[model samples]
Target: MQVETLVVVPVVLVAFVFYLTHNQTGLPRVGKSGPFGFILTALKSITSFADLLDEGLNKYGSKAFVVPTMAGSLIVAGPENVDLFKSSDDTAINQPISVDESLQLMHTLNSRQLALPFQAVVVRTDVTRAISAFIPEILEETRLAMAEAFALPFGEKSTTLPLFHTMTHLVARISNRAILGPSICRQEQYLHDIIRFAETLSIYGQLLTWFPRILRSPVYFLLSSAFGGPKEPARAIIPHLKMLLAEREQGLENAKTITDFLINLAPPEEIADVKLLAMRVLSVNFGSIHTSSIFGTHALFHLATLSESELDTIRHEIIEALESEGGYNKASLAKMRILDSTLREVGRFYALGVVCLNRVLIKPASLVDGIVVPSGYNITIPLKPIHFDENVYPEPYKFDCFRFSKLRASDHTDLKYGFTTVEKDFVPFGLGKHACPGRFFASMELKIMLSHLLLNYDLSLPGGAKEAPKPIFFNSHVIPDTKACVILKPRVGQAGQDL
Candidate 1:
């Protein structure tokens, strides 16, 4: 009976998956469609996602198509359907649901707080509005954090370190200083545990997708046991979060940190839920730390590849801005137009993924040309192709750091060309209503870090590499080269204190 049951279950699952794969969707399906065709396609997506996207675009121009993966089939929408993202009906088209599905968040996160809107609400409203006020602390944290991480002595000697790992630490510390305040953000153990939690959640999220839906729960349980789970790290923040909550209740704390905003804005019933609040903080940390660190590393790599004259041009801009504004503030950072352009160009050159505006339809929807897409389908836009479209951006293949800066100067449109600007062609931060809420804070943070690095040290790729390290693609995700090294040499006799 046991042997018969084992064989029967295997056959049943294969048949069920095969039936689902063959179900009619009435869309042009890309790649093979055999019983195991989805598996092959899934592998291709991990190894050559760009090639797969190009193939879909070439075969089915400006129309929706299906691309199968381990998670499920995705409806790859073309540029013509970009307006689908502008819809205001959250019930019909949900971004959070899409995130939960793609990241397996329901299982990986193991927390109900993710379903709540407290984090997004606070970030979009409080954190963003309070950025100007947080700039000084953020800048100071960036300075101290960088000095400690790089430790390039007080001479001409250079220091080499793993760019991605180092950037992750710096971002985590600086961002936490604003979120948790100085009291808890600098705690080495707390930062380490939270960082580990974020990594564990992401790793397990992807790993969970490798199993059939029926087997995922069992696999997750075993995996959690084998490789300590997100819980261990998540629990590490609770004690500290509890203290903050107590302090606020006792009138010993002010409404300054991100945690305070969350507590103030959270629904009345969940206001004092310590575990939920910790999860909310972890979620924020994951998004801000991962995205900012990856972006900063990319920008620094680009800086390393530029000519000495180009580097000087950026350095001069920073110095001029600091001098004119009398210090590093929001206005001074804004005046560093070249630096902003470089950061924007880095985003364009290497986006976090090959697709964006990911959404899961809750009800049947119609896109451009009146094409109807049924419910329960995952939809995403071809982000990389639109970014490289020559029709929108002249010479899209070249890495011109001055691309947007020149546009800002020639066209006299400052805001349109800024790093945080989101359009159909530039959707690194997504588009329309559901765009990343923390973008305002992230823009200021990246600008400050890049400017500080430019002013304090000369950056370069080790071994005189002409180009930045090539980005690694896992499925549609674009990961910066984690093993690449950047040599940082302190500028001789140049004081870093002024800026």
Candidate 2:
């Protein structure tokens, strides 16, 4: 009787799931079709998310299709359905909170930060305004990071380091100066842990999802630090954050930083816990550092391939702008237009994800031609194909350094064509109302690092090659090849430039 019950229960459950979803509710699937196929597709999706989505796009061709996940299938909206994604409201579909809920961020982040708009209160506002104050320190950190990492390679003698690792560290230190302040940023142990925390977000999310609902909290607690690199640091940093908060409370505020802004946010609660506030700080540090470091590595690789003449041009632009604007102010960074164009083009060419601006349905939502997404499914655009569309980017696969600068300089140009400006056709930073609020700060960091590199060093690949090392792909995420080496030789007249 017991054996029979076990087998019958699974059969009944399968029948019920198939009945409810109607095999993902008759959505056209990317891989195989039917109930058993979803399991196989889910495995493939985990192993290679980009390829699974690409297969769906190739098979369906502008028709919305489904990519199966371990939990269920997600609707991959086609180009025609971009409006459905862009114009949806939070009540209908939510962006961050929806994704965060799925990832079980409630267990990870401070409760006060759960639905609070970091865009308006923290990530976007304070950093964008006070970034200029950080430039002198950022330049100093960049120089130190570079010098320490590459030993002042000079003349024909160059320091060869893995491009990705070096950039990750350099960008981490620079981002730390902005996000955590100079005192904490310089601590080697703390810096190491923060970088580890950023690199493991996926691992943590996956670990949490492996357990059933009742077991999730136990699993999170058991494997806390193993998941996100922030767990241990969160515990250690609480007392320090408490000190900062107490100082603010006692009206001892002097320099307002990311710490002050986050502490000062008027959350739903009248008085926020200091521990939760510390976790919030760690969250911002991990996310900001991870994105900036990875993208900065990509841009640096792009520069490593530039001709000596091209190198001189970018360096001169940096110097000319710095001299004109009287040091590294906002106007000076803004005038480094060539660096901006290169950064944009690298992002366009090598973005890690196949789609952006993912919004999970908060409620059942209707679409054109009788298509309705039931609650809980995500709506995502097909990004790679649109990026490669000939009409959108001419010879789209080929990298062009000035692709966006020319667009900006064009007569009667729409600024949307520039790489930083996200539009329907371009969304490296996403599009519409929820486009990345931290982009201004990110752009500033990228420009500062790249400009510093050009102004201080001669960059090349080891083989005297004309091309940058080919980037590797993990599913859809393009990454700098960790094993590949980049050669850097310092130039004259820039030895103590930042110091």
Candidate 3:
């Protein structure tokens, strides 16, 4: 009886899933069809999603296809239909809903964050507008961070540092210097909590997706850091945030940080809530620290492989830009066209994911050829494939640091190829109105830090390796080699040129 019960239960569940998925979409599928196929595809999605996308595009051409995942089916639209992804009809296709569904934010994070995105709004407005004013702060923090993270001996000696870890540390400190302020940003405990929270949220969010939706909230509540099952660093930072909020109420006016902007932009009723404000800060840190550090590491790794003369070419551009503009301000950074191209090229090469512009349809939407996508289906653009399209980028796989700079030189009148420019083809920061609002700030921050590194130090792969370690790809994320090390030596005869 017991053996029969076990076999029957397995059969029943598979049959039920098969029933639910049958005829769910009219679009072509990238993998085998049916419940058993779904299981296989879901496993492949976790391990080799990019391969799955490549197979889909190769098989279906420019037509849309579905890729199954643990979360749900993703309707991947090809390059030809990218404009449909730029639709502003929030009621039909919504990016926030897609994010919430993808990350399971309603359970893992505070649902209020999804509903009230005051932090993002502040980033889109206050952060971008204040970039020029905070240039000195960013550069100072970059200098201090580099000195501390890579404290090598002067002349004929070098220190090897873990690339991703050091970049994260540098970005966290420098970004928080702009996000919170100088004193709090430097606090060891506070910085630890912020980094821990971002990591915890990412891990737990993906973990929770494997469970049934009905059990997710209960599972999260039971195992969350508040209950001592998992680490919730957001809770750890509440007191520090409350104190900051109190200081704000007591007339501590700081117009330069996100804290001030949140207070300025948030509704009066939500302003004094410590948990709300703490979560907001955590969200901002997660977005800034994780993504910036990843791409920063990518750019540095590519730079590490370059010949000394190639490095000098970029260094010379930075020095000229600084001299031409008299300082490290917005205008000066803008003049560093090669620096911008280097960063942009790294993005185009080591993209963040296999797809972008993910949206969840709340209502039925029709596309070309009278194909109607049913409500609640997830949609994504094939970003990685588009980035590597031979028709779009010549020698797309090569790490040509001057790719965009050469493009700009040809046109001379077009800013479309700039680092911050977003189009259908090049979309590391995403595309359209819902694109990353903090890109202007991120671009400035990354450029400043990279410029500082170029001027003050020389970087090479440890042990004289010709290339940096290969980046790791898991599920959809393209992460820089987290454990890779780079040798850093003080640049000779470049003391006064440091940012």
Candidate 4:
């Protein structure tokens, strides 16, 4: 009798699932043949995400096509349906759902405790107004990383280091200084744990997202347990966090950082719980570290591959800006046009992913040309062509470092194109009301780090400038060559070793 009951339950679940999927309406189906063919094609698409998107673009670049999923079909489109994202309201097209689905944060983050106070911190402190005061400290941190962490030669001797691993440490130190205070940031143990914890988040976070809807709950439970039981990142960093939160609780703290902001973001009733506080820090680290390292590493590779003439231009720009601005102020960092433009080019070619502005339709959406998108559909903008199409950018395949700077020089141009400048076509940060709010501060960090690298080190790729290292794409990320190495030598008049 028990065996017969289990068989009946399984058959019922299958029938219910099939009926539910079949009833999903409005989305134009993609792929050949019927439902069986789509199941096979969708399975293939899971392995080769980029190739699948490219195939879809070739067939339906201008219109929305449904990518069949177990839950139903998802609405995926290229430039033609970009308005579906840009012009849609957050109420109709949900941004939080898209981010939550892609990153699997809801499994780890508490609904009550997940308010983002860091954006408040960034806007209040690190944007144009308060970041000026942080310039010297940032410059100091970069130089400290170069000398102690990097240990570049004081004299003629230098070292060959793996680009991704080395840049990870450098960025960890810099970002930690800004997020946590210098005392915690400088600790060897905290640095190792936080960096490793962020890396683990990337590895495990993506694994959780691979499961289909039917298996999501069970698969998530399995992987989440293996990933140190949801409080893993917090558990790893909480030792450092506890001491500081205790300090603040006792009113013994004089300085404030993102930790203070996290406390502020917490609900008043539960703000004192150090465990919840650590969770907030975990969220910030999870978002910042991976993206920061990706852009930093890619820009470093390009900097390593630059010609002597280009290097001279970068060096000259840095020197002139620093000298004119009376040192490396926020204004000085802002004025490094050559350095900023180079990083922009790197961002364009190697963004965090090939897709952006993803939204899940909560309320039904109506588009122009009599198209209606039913609720419960996921829509995404394929950013590959918007970034690289020849029609948008002439000679798009070539790497022109001064691409935006040249554009800024046009006769009627009023605004200079910095890395943070977001236009319709130029959105490495993202698009719309929910676009990356921390871009200004991120640019400052990247520019300062890159500026110090150019000013202090003679850089090179492993084989030669000719051998271009390829970026690896999996799911949504464009991962730079983690295994590639760069040779470095300290400049003659550098002042960072003793710091």
**What tens-digit string does per-residue lDDT give for candidate 2 at 372-468?**
7777676677678767788878989888777877776774463455446777777778766777777888888888888877777788888887677
Note the Cα lDDT for every prediction shown: 0.80, 0.71, 0.79, 0.69
lDDT of 4 at 496: 33
lDDT for predicted candidate 4 compared with the true structure = 0.69
- Model 1 per-residue lDDT at 253: 78
Runs of candidate 2 with Cα error greater than 4 angstroms are 1-23, 118-120, 152-156, 225-228, 266-272, 412-419, 470-476, 494-499
Descending-lDDT candidate ranking:
1, 3, 2, 4
Q: Candidate 1 — number of clashing residue pairs?
A: 1
Q: Candidate 1 at residue 54, lDDT? A: 83
Q: Write the per-residue lDDT of candidate 3 for residues 315-414, one digit (tens) a residue.
A: 8888888888998998889988887998888778876776778788889887665678887788877875678988889888788888998889898944
- lDDT tens digits by residue: candidate 1, 94-200: 78788787777677664464467668888999999999889999989988888888896566389998999888888889999888888777888777876776656
Models sorted by TM-score, best on top? 1, 3, 2, 4
lDDT of candidate 3?
0.79
Model 4 ranges with Cα > 4 A deviation: 1-32, 68-72, 78-84, 113-129, 152-156, 212-218, 224-232, 236-242, 411-416, 493-499
Clashing pairs in 2: 197-229, 352-477
Please give, for residues 1-499, the per-residue lDDT of candidate 4 as tens digits.
Answer: 6999889668855764463345265555655556566665555555456776777778866576676543346677556656557666678888877776666665645543224444445444444354665667777888887777557555548788888888888888887777776877777766776777677765555665444455556766776576544454465457766776688779887545666556555565545576766766766766677788888888888777778788878788788888888877777877787777777887788788877777888887765545777887777777778888788778988777778767766733534477887777777787776677667767888888887787778888876764458888766567888898888877776533122
How many Å off is the CA of 151 in candidate 2?
2.0
Candidate 1 similarity to native, TM-score:
0.93
**Candidate 3 deviates by what RMSD?**
3.2
Better of 1 and 4 by lDDT: 1
